[model samples]
Target chain A: MRVALFITCLADQFFAESGVHAVKLLRSLGVEVEFPARQTCCGQPAYNAGYWNEARSMAEHTLDVFQDAEYVVLPSGSCTTMLRAFYPELFRERSSKFKQAEDLAGRTFELAEFIVKVLGVTKLGDGLRGRKVAYHHGCHALRELGIKQEPLALLANAGAELVDWPASQECCGFGGLFSVKLPEVSLSMADQKISTLPRADYLTSALAGCLLHLSGRMQNHRVGLETTSPYGLSEVRPLASLLWQAVEGAA
Target chain B: MKASPNNYPEEAALVIREHPEVRASVTGATLNFDQNRRKAYSEIDTEAWRVWAEAVKNHLLTHLDGYLRQAEASLVANGVQVHWAEDAEAAQQILARLVRENQVRTVVKAKSMLSEELGVNPLLESLGARVFETDLGEYIIQLENEPPSHIVGPAIHKNLEEIRQVFHRHFGTALNETPEALAAVARKRLRDAFLRAEMGISGANFLAADTGTIALIENEGNIRLSTSTPRIHVALVGIEKLVPRFSDLAVFLSLTARAATGQRLGTFVSLIQGPRKPGEHDGPEQVHVILVDNGRTSVLADPEAWETLRCVRCGACLNACPVYRQTGGHAYGYVYSGPIGAVLAPGLLGLEAAKALPYASSLCGACFEACPVRIPIPKLLLAWRSRAVEQGMTPRFEAAAIRAYAFTMTHPLLYRLAARFIRYLPDQVLDNRVVPVVKAWTEGRAGLKPSPKSFRELWESGEAQ
Candidate 1:
């Protein structure tokens, strides 16, 4: 399938490594990814800040850039949700724009959602060496995309033992601009999130932004646990070896 | 008069920051409430729950006038007086008239956000009636001369230490900073008021319009005592609180208890159909059901905004909201706070009064997900923002900005040019500068640093692919 990769501004700038991992993982899954050269930000920052017009412009830019793609996938759940769920509402009054927005939303999917729901890839060609992993379900993915079980399903298939946290669905306090806007509140909420993690070998989530925020707090507090995106874990083993090993084990 | 709601966000942010202990207490309490609610709701099928909840609410709202008429007739038949108040002033007058007619000197109130919304306590106090708040949380906030932070947990913003101080200052007794001790003190203080008060005033959680029944759900037994011991029991509720039938109560009752406190049922779900029976030993002689409209009709008229009235006021959304969890309920600046409050307050009290509230959310959909009655709170909030702008209630600059945005978005060339310009803007130019109207965005936070290379540049260079 020809896919338009919506590398959210967060991934493009801060977590470029996760973007690389996503590309590698997608290519391994036999997906051809296209980068729309004209795409800028998803306009979530502007939309969330109540700058609806600025956000609308950004949304329009995104729509114009990737209007022809067969499938639009994003690494970030929140941004993908913005495109697929909220962008239509942004253009509610304009019939032509609304149609475009609807079309974009209909085709767009979050990473795990695209993999599980669209691509039907339960078993990614990935392997992990017996690490007890806990999943941090980002608020947007859990609530908007409803991709709660898909990532966990993939992680389990990758041979990682999943341990559930008490409040796994809670926000990691990286509410994009909210982290800086409400710093103390953000830190406190992040503190609560980090504290909720069970003592596991590694913590993983689909959204790199949430992981970065949680990891910053964990590092500050000296929690001694590593955090990675699901793709990062998936890309560690070569596709041939991982698939062959899985086949051999199954036989 | 309280400061305009427009000034609330800044003041509330400052208040929350200054009082770290109160914020911590609210955060702790809300976190548990949120988690327990999730666990409880997960036990039930979500789709079925939504259908059941929606059916009950829709049935009630559709037949609201009919139900109110039936309830009034039933109450009157049972010898309880029914009064209709067009607004808060009329409601206050009705209460004052009741007090004068009965020659009532004291009034005991169970936790009522409606009363707070109407500023009822001060009005009653000015009329020479000694008003006492009966619910533990309500009593603490009452003593402190503050608004209830959370809908269900009235004094959710108060910690034990603050409660102890309020108790010490009010009762002139040394108090300890513990939940049990504070509850004991409040219980002791409120018991006398309940026993001697001539009138009991409480908010109705749900008015069973089918049978003229007022359902009061309380964890504390104070509501029961307050309603029973008084000579006159007055239940004031918004017109929207009516549920069409007694059977409909089952759905709401189940959703409310689990959604509010994570209990299978509250310790007490008192269903008072009317005034006490003639042979009844311990019940009020007169029961009055006061239906207060107070801007609800205006909200009801707007179909998009009307779903806010379906709120059970369970505080589930407040607990679930990331912004509310961080800033606490005070930031919303109304009697109702959190997601429901953000949507409802603007419609009820004009958009200008609550212009900032619609922007208070992260639009995370947690509020919608947590809502028991399935109110699309985030959608309503965004709709309110649009309405606010259309009504010329938003700041002129913001309206112009959005208009300019709408214009730019229609033109692809302009949009691309703007993006390129944004990319070229210096980090210093974008950094740490407070923009007009949206200073709320950068009040405590550093501004976004401009990107050296736009996503377009990287994409064009084949780096992002």
Candidate 2:
């Protein structure tokens, strides 16, 4: 299957490694991965901020870029959900663009959801062992994409114990630009989320934008937990390359 | 300290930011209200509530004219005068005439957003009649001379310390900063006004068209006193508050309390059809039902915006709104705030004044989910936005930007080039002088970084492979 990668702007700029891991993971599953370089931000920032025209521009760019791909996948659930869900509404009046947006949305999938549900690849050819990981479900992914269990299922397959994070679905207060616009409220919400995190070895989620906000706060607070995307954890080759390598090798 | 409705958004934003403590207090209060409301709704069978509520609302709306006539006839039969006000001015004149005819000097009122809509209190006071707000929350705001920030919790924006200060200044009484202590003082102060006032004015929660009954739901007991103590009781109600049957009350009764305060029922739900019976010991001598259209009929004509009339004024949507949480209800620059308020203010007030209300949401759909009557508030808000733009009510810069956007997005090559160019701009250039209009977006957020390569470039280059 030829899968087009929509490495969201956040992932491209800040979390490049997630992009590499996504490509690696898809290729490892015997899927042909195509990067659509014309793709930029999904226009969600513009759309949510009531800059509908800018968002429509971005949506149009995205739709045109991935026009030929059999399936469009993104590592960030929020961006994919934006593409799959909201873009159609943006172009509801313009018949041609509306149809295009609808078509693009219908074929788009969040990374784990596409892999586990569509591709049916639960266990990769490799695994990481002996790590207790807590999953932070991004609000859009949980509510919009409905990719709740697929990420967990893939984590379990990779041999990581999923630590239950209380209020995991609560927003980390990184509502795109909401953090800057309402910094005090955003910081307060983020602080509350940090308090809910149990002491775990690793924290992970698919959307890197959320991780950037969470990890930035964690760094500022000097909290001692390594944060990584699921793609980062899954793409660790040979199953025993890190601290859990010896455990995997012994097994 | 009159809150003139002019430049209200800027004023509200200033108020919200200037008093960080009030902002924090409203935020905390809203969070608690939201949680309690969620718990209350969850306890009930939501599906059942939705069906029943929708059925009752639809029935009322479809037969609105007939029901209004029936209610009028029934009230007349009960010897209660039913007066129709075509608009706010007419409503005010009718009310003022009634007050003058009786030579009423003092009038006490229960909490009523409808009265606020008509500016009834000030109008009556201007007519030389003293008007007192009897609800504890309303009384605090009336003393401070501000509008109710939250629909149901009128004083939700004021912290206990603020309330204590307001009470100390207005009532000349020393009271501690506790709910019970504060309530006692307000009750004592209002009980006299209720007893002495010859005319009572209250907002109706629901006016049963079939039974000609006006329903008043309150957690505080002032509404009952306001209705019963005065010799003449006048209930001012919006035309949209009418419901066809007494049976429909059960659905509204369930939804209103649960949605507003997360209680199975409010402390008091008073249904008054007319004045005192002959043998009645404590009841008003004359009951007047003033049905005020005041732009509601015009709103009903717009199919896209009419669902706003289904609102029960529960404030559940206000509590659940993200924007309302951060900025509080005041920032919406209207008596109504949150999702329902956004759609409502423009329809009732005019799009020119309330244009900002429509854009004040993330379209999270939480309000729609929270609405007991299942009003699709977010959709209506978006529709209002589109209408505002189409009507040239949006700012010129925003309109131009959207036009540029619509043009560029339809063309792929221009978009790709623009994306590539934007990626290379320095952070300083991107973050230069703040765009005051969109300061909400670029203020604290990570400035947008133009991607090094377009998704198309990467895809065409086979780098993705």
Candidate 3:
């Protein structure tokens, strides 16, 4: 299946490494991956801030970009929710645009959900081992998408030891406009999550916005933990280098 | 004691800083309430019951006039005097007139949020009537000479030490008294006030239409005492509190009990049909029920916002809200607090007065999941936000920024150019705290560092493949 990467604006601008790792992980599993250059954003900021017209415009732009793709997968769970759940709400129910949006939403999946549920490839051949990790389940993914076990299943398959993190299901305070709009409550929420964060070598989640907020706060507080997405944790190599390792390991 | 709902950001910030110790108790209390509610819900099909509960509330809201008329007629038939008040001022006037006509010098009150909203205590006192709060939490707040912070747990924000201090200062009790001792003092004091007072006032949990019975749930028997001890028992009820049938009480009782305090049944669940019967020996002689609109009709007229009136006042949404959990009830600057407060206050007070309340949420949706009636709180918050924008209540800069963002996002080429342009901006200027408009975001967080290169730039340059 050809998977079009919906690298969220956050990933495209700041955390591009996670996107690079996502591509490698997919290609390693023998899946055709394509980058839709026109894809910019899922319009979460505008939509969430009550800017319906802006959100609709951005949503339409996204729909036009991924119109022909067989499967649209992205690393950000929050954006995926905006697409899969919120897009239909942006348009009238009986409108043709709403139908098309629903069709797109049906095929759209978060990276981990696409991997475990769709691709059916669980174990990644012992590439990740002996690592104590905590998966900070973003609120949108856990509450909105109902994705709890997929990421855990993937981590367990990769042979990573998952530690108990406090308030794992709570928001990391990266509520798009919320973080900036009400920074005190946002930081306090993030502080609450971090105070409960069990000591670990690595803390990861699928959404980069969370990782960005958490990693920034963790750095400020001098908490020692490598924060990244699941793809970034695999075997410590770029996709190109990982492809060579995959070939050599198969031999 | 003034509500700062208009300045939520500052008020929330102040609460976060000043009430540092409140965090643990609020967290512990809410978490406990949530867990107990979950367990209580496990005993039955909570989802199905919630759907039924929502339907019942929706039905009552749609046909409120009929149900309320039926309730008033049944109440009159049951020998309960019924009065109508169009708003808070009118309600206060009616209650004052009742007190004056009865020549009542002292009045005992049960936990009544309506009275609080009406600012009844001060009015009564000003009218030369001494009002004693009967509920332990209400009594404690009454002693403190402050507004009740929470609907159910009025004194939840106070620690034991503070309570001891308050009791010591006012009741001249020993400073080393335990909570049980404090409760005993309040109980003894209220018991005396309950007997001496000529009139009693209380809030109804639910007003049953068929029987004209007011169903009240409380752990402390203060409501019973307040309603029964005086010659005249007056119940202040929001018009929206009416349920169509006596049988509907079962579902609401279960939902409110489990949702409020995780109890399958309240310690005292009183369904008073009317005044004392001829055969009755101990109950009050004259029972009065006042149905106060107080902007409810305005709420009912709003197609989108009318759902705010479905609240059972169980305080479940307040306990489940993360913002309320953090700031407690006082920060809301209104009688109602938390997610429900955010929506309901605006509906009643209008967008301009309660504008900040709608923006106070993180939109986490915890309150929605925990609502027994499934009120869809997050959706209401969103709707309010849209209303705020449409009314042009947002700051000019904020409105302009959102429009600019929308413009940039729709045009991908512009979005890409902006994205590329943002990468080159220095970290110093990009710091959200120092930035004129984005300062709201960085007040509590360190600034973000933009990525060095756009993923599209890399993918197009053949490095991504």
Best prediction by lDDT: 3
Candidate 3 CAPRI level: acceptable
**Backbone N/Cα/C clashes per model:** 0, 17, 1
Q: Candidate 2, residues B1-465: lDDT per residue as tens digits?
A: 233333444555566446767667877898788888889888979878887887788778878899999989878888889899999999999999899999999999998999988899889889899889998888988998888889998888888888888877876657565778778888887888988899999999998877888898998888999998999999999998988887788878868899888888889999897998888787999999899998998888997898888888989988877566655666666778777888898899888877767765555566776788888886787678667766777568655765575555556466666666766777766544465523443343334444466444554566644
Which residue segments of model 1 deviate by more than 4 Å?
A: A13-17, A46-61, A91-100, A126-135, A159-168, A174-251, B1-3, B172-182, B391-465
| Candidate 2 fraction of reference contacts recovered | 0.12
The TM-score, computed over Cα atoms with residue i paired to residue i, of candidate 1 is 0.86
RMSD of each: 5.2, 5.5, 3.8
lDDT of 2 at B434: 62
- Place model 1 in a CAPRI quality band: incorrect
DockQ of each: 0.22, 0.20, 0.47
Candidate 3 regions with alpha-carbon error over 4 angstroms: A221-251
> Candidate 3, what DockQ?
0.47
Per model, how much of the real contact set is kept?
A: 0.18, 0.12, 0.50
Model 2 agreement with the true structure over A24-138: per-residue lDDT tens digits: 6677677898775556678776666556766777787788889999999888888887898789889888999999999998899888888788988777533445566677777
For each candidate in turn, the TM-score is: 0.86, 0.84, 0.93
Best by TM-score: 3
